[model samples]
Target: MANVAISELDKNCGKVVAEIVKLERKIFPKHESLASFFENELKKKNSGLLYLHVDGELAGYVMYSWPSSLYASITKLAVKEQWRRQGHGEVLLKAAIEKCRTRKVSCIMLHVDPLRTPALNLYKKHGFQVDCLVESYYSSDRNAYRMYLDFDSS
Candidate 1:
């Protein structure tokens, strides 16, 4: 595995935005985050982005938001297909979790497609529990598990 570095994306970096869009399209062909929404998120004080770089390439990223003091929500997490199984996703996830802790959020929440077993297992390993089932959460054909990691407990 190549050494990976984590960096917070700067809102002013247009190049980073373009790279992110490209990666999103490849990783999430049907559910790509809109460029306008992504750009808007970059400008938000309560939102954050973490990028995992392997030898100067974008290996993965996590985008999250602290909409309120009570909870932090992970909007997206993706690792390049080539980077899967190398722990890049967890690295980005841990960084995002730490960022939430810094803001003193009570819990971190995320939704994952139920069919995505690998992702479900990853969240479970990180202390996230299924809070509920969100029917058609992602789209009409997809359902989701609403998982949460509470900071109040160990």
Candidate 2:
């Protein structure tokens, strides 16, 4: 069996951040990627990253931020192409939600491309409901669904 682990990314871990940046570039379009600003984002008190490793190799990560006590946003979730469809994304997502739960947040929100079926399914399976269709959320050609999981209602 593959050994799996999930842990919060430490701001001081430069090597890990670099690896994540490389992975981010591969997974997201340049205009939509937060890779260039990831380190800076991590430095913020309310922002953090959770990474999942399979057999000691980075498989996926989730970036989240809580700008206010009552709400949190999941800005990114990406699994390596080879690791896709293997439940790594779900694991990382669960970890991020748990982190928000521990902080007593009332709602967790995220935006996903409407056309990304696998991702939309994953979020829906975890109780995230579409609140609205965000036109041009990603780019001129791409639209997104603004989804949210309300802990108070669940």
Candidate 3:
């Protein structure tokens, strides 16, 4: 638990990609194309990818996908295992929410593993509520819990 800073992730996209791969392997252990898609879209202004730096090192990352006319989707959010419970997740999440507010987006959504109780609780604490259950959503056939947060104009 050190000084943590989050900024738009670009130069660190590759590291973020690797961290996700690490998570994937720890869980169902499969490679997917979503990581590459996010990396490519980072060069565009309408899209954003957030990274966390703590104690002067890249500790975690998160991202929101803005595709033309869709509600910005939280594509990924991962903090290295050693850095968990240090509040970096909440920091990145608030950053993402603020990013949406700045863009005038009214709703933000994300998908989380239904079995990850801690993560589900974390999102709930931040005002994200379950929207739906995406059954067999991943290559590993793991269920995904879709969550949404509505931003108020006032």
Candidate 4:
């Protein structure tokens, strides 16, 4: 948490997407669409990404979307393998949640694969609850659980 600079996200934004592809071990966004998608979205929102850096190296990245909605959606979040279990994920999420709350967002939302136990647990520990399950949500070959956190809890 002490070694994070949200501004450095763009440097390794694409890498974070690649890392997610590796970590999830699922067929997703083989092309650079995911990475490029963030660029476009961020540009549209006039917002930026939040980056987590550890030991002077980029460790993770998260994309936040706040489109006149009450909830800020976490479009993506991923940490490098070596940086996991060090509380970086929590730190990144905290930063994002705070940012949204400061902007008057009522809540934060994110999605995780039901099969990803660790991710589900992490979200739960951070006050995110399974709001609902989206059938065939991810690429029609996978399902995703939408999680939400009320800003008042922060």
lDDT against the true structure, each candidate? 0.88, 0.93, 0.73, 0.71
Q: Worst 10-residue stretch by lDDT in candidate 3? A: 27-36
Count clashing residue pairs in model 4: 1
Write one digit per residue (lDDT tens) for candidate 4, span 7-28: 5345445765455345433323
TM-score of each model, in listed order = 0.95, 0.97, 0.80, 0.77
Q: Rank the candidates by lDDT, best first.
A: 2, 1, 3, 4
* TM-score of model number 3: 0.80
Expressed as tens digits, the lDDT of each residue in 10-87 for candidate 3 is 664676656655553553334533543444666667778777878777777776865544367787777777888888
Model 2 bad stretches (over 4 Å): none
1 or 4: which has the higher lDDT?
1
Stretches of candidate 4 off by over 4 Å are 1-33, 152-154
Instruction: Write the residue-wise lDDT of candidate 1 on 1-154 in tens digits.
Output: 5767999988577887789878887778456455546787778999999988898898889999999999999989999999898888888888999998999999999999989998999999999999999998878888899999999994
Clashing pairs in 1: none
lDDT of 2: 0.93
- Tens digits of per-residue lDDT for model 2, 1-154: 9999998898577888898999999989899988888888889999989988899998889999999998999999999999999999999999999998988999999999989999999999999999999999999989999999999999
Instruction: Give the C-alpha miss distance for residue 77 in model 2, angstroms.
Output: 0.3
User: Measured by C-alpha RMSD in angstroms, how accurate is candidate 1?
Assistant: 1.3
Best model per TM-score: 2
